[model samples]
Target chain A: MLATAAAAIALIFLQQAPAEDIDWDAEFGVEERERDPATGEFPVDPYEKSNANAGAEPFANGRLAAAFGGREGIRRIAERTVELSEADPRIAEIFVAHDTVRLKRTLSEQFCYLLGAGCDYTGRDMRATHDGLGIRTADLNALVENLQQAMREAGVPFAAQNRLLSKLAPMSGDVVER
Target chain B: MRTPCVATGLMLAILSAQPAHADDLEWFEGGKLVLTNGVTTIEGTSGGGIATWATIAGLEMDNGVGVSGHATIIELPDYGWQSHGVAVGIANRVELSYARQNFDTRDVGTALGLGEGYVLNQDIFAAKLRLLGDVVYGDPLLPQVSLGVEYKRSLDGDVAAAVGAARAEGLDYTLSATKLFLSRSVLVNATARLTEANQNGLLGFGSAAGAGHSLQFEGSLGYQLSRRAVIGAEVRTKPDNLGLGEDDWFDLFAAYAVTDNITVTAAYVDLGSIATFEDQRGAFLSAQVAF
Candidate 1:
């Protein structure tokens, strides 16, 4: 009886022993994400991507794009805007823990698409992306100021800068929660 | 989830450990774009030198308080005018202002039998409330609008009576709308005023002839030259109750923000006539500081 009980206990311990140290994440069915090698952005859940996600129609004329220095200039401006916002104390709290790697890429795409620089936007819509972010009007304004500063540094003409602002200004409705 | 809970506890501990005065002086928050506060006018309101705009006088955004002060001088041919004023804006919603205007009758005073250096002074107190829309946001077609009331008291009542002004003190009402066309970099403003004051109350209110009040129109159009500069024109029509040839006023102005807290405006103004002084055109200069 003692030998049979020992064998039974030994079999149960062997079956229960973890093969590796412990993947509590795997045990709880947690999703793991790795950054893309090229883009350096973590993977997000699948969603439909369309040009409508760009939020506004592209400029019919390429004059503004030319003034903005085309796709390269626009991408730089967008990334710089995100960088400045991350550094700005007034709005740092909103960006600190956020996925800025994805932000840089998506923002560049959106700006390039909207400025008529010949790029298709593949990001989610503004409302969907900003949902639950708890952003306020003041925070949005801070972001705009940072964007303006970036454009200024890029030598975008003030009026041309406003041309892009006109398109984004209306989107405050979706982005600002309070 | 455990990590988040631990992070929350750490945040709570740090927040409680912060000094008591860490966030006390937060009322003077400034979040509006540059020059969006508008330049303070001679009347202690945000406007284009002579006309009132719907924008409140402040460097503040919502839930913040701001204050502005201005001193202005309009060097007319026969008379000199100077005004010093201060205004307070509450959360971009309401504004309260006080201005003291001094009309130095230079030679005009002597012509009217008063001393050459005599000054006609008036105190103006005003309050305004924003009614709808925003100056810089929301629908592009919708403009910011406001309603305001002003009470003016003339210090030289006897002299005002001599100039045919019936009352020494009176009330004025104003409704204004202003908009900034961001894409085009243009600004437009219009104001309708109901008043019985003569010369904006420097000559007092109404007249024995009894046209107590009349609707007046004030308009301004501006082009943004840069983030820190704007060029504008204004037309403000006034009542001729005193009949001293108090014709309409017109000006072309350039406003420049020297810094975030300081703005200076220079203009060439045309006051058709004042106290029978015809061809009263001259330079208008003003400096304002806001925070």
Candidate 2:
């Protein structure tokens, strides 16, 4: 009698097992899961999708490219940075040897690359270059202002500029020492 | 005439040596750098069959560099007495410390008779490097974390190891996270110490025969009472090695800035001792002057 009862219990347990667990793909349609969200409307994970820079140049698309005006826009901003930097020796000293103008030029180019604009930055490592300089908060704020001005002069739209700025905001802490 | 000339020359030298102060300037502007001329004392109990007492005195600079000498006196009724000491700093994100401890078994009396006599004196040298975290920076939301390691070497060999010491020389590591909540006017500092040393290597080392590691937690909360005054309370723990007592300590501390160049601190401490001996608690005060 006990053995018969045990057999009945096993049968009930087997029946209770979820069929969906046995056939997951059948329950959730595989093809329907992969479609991108509709255009003119943001995705649920907009930041994740926008920041989905999988390789060497991470900021190449979406907002950053528009901010730098694609290739021509980035080049124009770089040129202006060099002109302004040359006018101010203190600014010039912020960059390394032979990099006085190149560094400024690369800022816009780098923004373009990050915005998915298909450009390469190829700049020096951030931390090693800035260590021990005691860069003050005011110094960084000034640099950001100058870059913003150059962007405005180049006619990069305001919204695009903001999007790119947001990406760089978190790095302020690791860069500022004093 | 010669004596008068010499006196005048001496006066000129003294005047030149004094630090210049801009009399025309207001008391504080352009962010005054207040020098600390004050004493800070740790409040912890002391004394027992296994007793421990530690104190540090010196100046903590505005740039976060502190120089102070520390001394500790411990007593083991059956084993006799032991004392350790050192001087150290917290600057350039680096800490360097040196200490020496003596162990003497008084009961052996005249037999070991080398003078109060056949005691073991161990010299310890320690250095720590801060890998991350700044005590001065950060918003109220983010806690600052600083990772550091301390390497302590004991000079007296067999004598130090005889008491089941941690090692003739061993490295102690610690990580501290501190946050200053400006809006609340409170500072919270927490520390996790990893070590095998008994009483922080004060009594030579830990009793563990093999590699041993113990985790200790310390927390301090300070309130800024005014621009130049702060008061705080701290609780810290230690390991019980002599098998004689519980491990706990606490203190209430206060600091006052006397001038731009001086600060003072004081504290009441309670440090529990081994077994059931009297609590080793006392009052301490210190003064600091920075240039």
Give the best candidate by TM-score.
Answer: 1
The CAPRI-style docking tier of model 2 reads incorrect
**Which stretches of candidate 2 lie above 4 Å from their native place?**
A1-178, B1-92, B99-124, B153-163, B166-168, B208-211, B289-291
Per-residue error at B89 for model 2, in Å?
A: 6.2
Residue-by-residue lDDT tens digits, candidate 2, B1-291: 678679978999878866553222221111212211113221111111111111112233223344543333433343343343433433334445555555454544344333445665555554444455433343335554555555555555564555556566655666666654543556577778776655455445566555467787776777766546778887878776645464687777776777644566666666556323446566545444432
Against the true structure, what is every candidate's RMSD? 8.8, 28.5
Winning model by lDDT = 1
Q: Give every collision pair in model 1.
A: none
Residue by residue across B154-204, what tens digits does model 1's lDDT show? 999998898888999999999999998988999999999999999888888
> Using DockQ as the measure, which candidate wins?
1
**What is the alpha-carbon lDDT for the whole of candidate 1?**
0.88
Q: Which ten residues in a row have the lowest lDDT in candidate 2 chain B?
A: B44-53
Residues A1-178, candidate 1: write the lDDT tens digits: 5676799999998885567778899889998778899988888889999999888998877779988888888888999999999999988988877789899889988888888888889899999999988786667778888998999999999999888888888787788785
Q: What is the TM-score of each candidate against the true structure?
A: 0.88, 0.44
Candidate 2 lDDT over residue span A48-131, tens digit each: 222223223365335556557677877777667666655654345554333444455546555666667776554444454366
